[model samples]
Target: MPASSHRPSPASPLEDDNLLPQILLRLPPDPSSLPRASLACTRWRDHVANPGFRRRFRLHHRRNPPLLGFFDGCGSLDFHPTLEAPERFSLKRDEGDGVRRPLGCRHGLVLLLVPKPLQVIVWDPVTGDQHRLDVPQGLTMNECYESVINGAVLRAAAGDAEHFKVVMVAADGDGVENRRAVACVYSSETGAWGGFVTAPIPYDADAHASGLFWRFSTSIYIDHAMLAGDSLYWQLIGNFEGILQFDLERQSLSVMSVPVPIYSKGNCFKLMRAEGGGGIGFLLMSNSDYIAQLWRRKTDSDGVA
Candidate 1:
């Protein structure tokens, strides 16, 4: 048989440009996955480094991205790896003053709060990209209760890993009858902070009757924000003990009381997505009975839980 007539053995399936990406896309969505794959050869490196491939890789694993590690924001800002050796990644410890606190992490980004100058740092550990945004005038130290400020970071749009947005919320008051919740959002794409959204915190009659109103006035304890539907929820503790809601689509702020009353301190509660992904809710542990209760916001009703 002529040499030209005889067919050469089938080239490795991965040699095909189309097939190569499909195989790489199945790789675990680990911090070191792409980099390690790229070391294989120039061809593989080019495929892994392609912008299109990167986007697809993220989308393919969008539903369940691996928990690479967590930032230890207690006393110091450090990353503790959870993955095994060789695949594990490490981030440089925060060199600035220990005032930096990790407010929340979502969409592969970390939101940090720096209280001194009242700034928010949106960091992407994988990309080593950092964006420092000045706190909005209304949410700044001089304007609001600086110690109670918290925020969250998320992708600007679904399945979008490049652009992101930061939502910062704070409780502000004059120690009089003007207590309120204020929130402002910073968009990376726009490179600016949006106008402030304010919601009046209703007076707690019980707190006032117990003579605890004044002490808690102008002060609030806000937990990390949780995203659900088109809104972000934060568990509020203080005179106005409820969940503060920031509607991303409407750009409005509102508050909803918890199903059961909870005190300012000595209570354990968390804001989370309701079961079956219905809506936002909270899990509260009763101090007296030591029993946990799950409460879901009634999206069909008027914010009842």
Candidate 2:
């Protein structure tokens, strides 16, 4: 026989099968890369789609967390505290455009609502992504409409241990009959604005009274929330005195009160759940400085006086 004929025959199909599992086990976890490898063949996709493979992919995404971009000056970027631990970002008028007042932020996005007529810009704090969302169309149509302003908050929720919610409130244009206040929520998981909720303004007196409670309340809001297994606990300043909790799952409201000093009319800032006894603290700005006042659970030492 010729020397070339001495080559061994190809390995049985079983040998090819044995090699596949090994290749799948080693595929790169980057979601961008995994999708491409999956296109190579049916077997590749099967392996890439494995639950174990997906878990690893998720882990990688978790590690390379996206950065939230924000603006300090009109054209400049603000970088402090990083995105992980947020520090309060301030807002001022754009001077040139009287319409865009730098409003506070909620989720990674900040709101800039034009004072009178109503124009709004939702800008991301990390990427500086800007989205111009219109005020609820229904509110604009009414001829009786008058003043308007937007309020926002930002936070990140942990597991069941804590729930974080960002509330976007609109001080409706007061009509002779009602103060048509509206509240909408932007959730991290669903990444969409929640349905518009209507609440009758408790005080019919004037615009000044609408935000009275916000002056002294201490509230915590999440800048982002996870889906699949995330939890959100939120409280709403239903009028000045009635506090309400919004359960994300049931999409319903429950009545609750933020402790006296905790929700009092003040600079309303910074909140974290307490340890052991589990209370909440409200930070207030006095004169020109800020202070932390902790409100703990009332002990049996004395019943409600």
RMSD of each: 3.5, 10.5
When summed lDDT is taken over every stretch of 10 residues in candidate 2, the lowest stretch is 220-229
Per-residue accuracy of model 1 over 180-281 as CA lDDT, tens digit each: 888888888989988888888877767644233334664445467788899998877666667888999999998777756655334577878999866887
Top lDDT hit: 1
Q: In model 1, how many backbone clashes occur?
A: 0
Candidate 1 stretches with Cα past 4 Å from truth are 1-15, 86-98, 208-214, 218-220, 264-266, 299-305
Judge candidate 1 against the unseen true structure and give its global Cα lDDT, from 0 to 1. 0.77
Tens digits of per-residue lDDT for model 2 on 1-305? 76665778887868866777566546543224566778998877886778665544444444344444444433233545545445444443355445355555543456565544454565644333455444545542244122333444444342211122444444344333344445566654455567766544344233234345443322222212112112223333423433333344555433334544333455463334444554332333433346655543344656541
lDDT of 2 at 272: 41
**Which residue window of length 10 is worst by lDDT in model 1?**
85-94
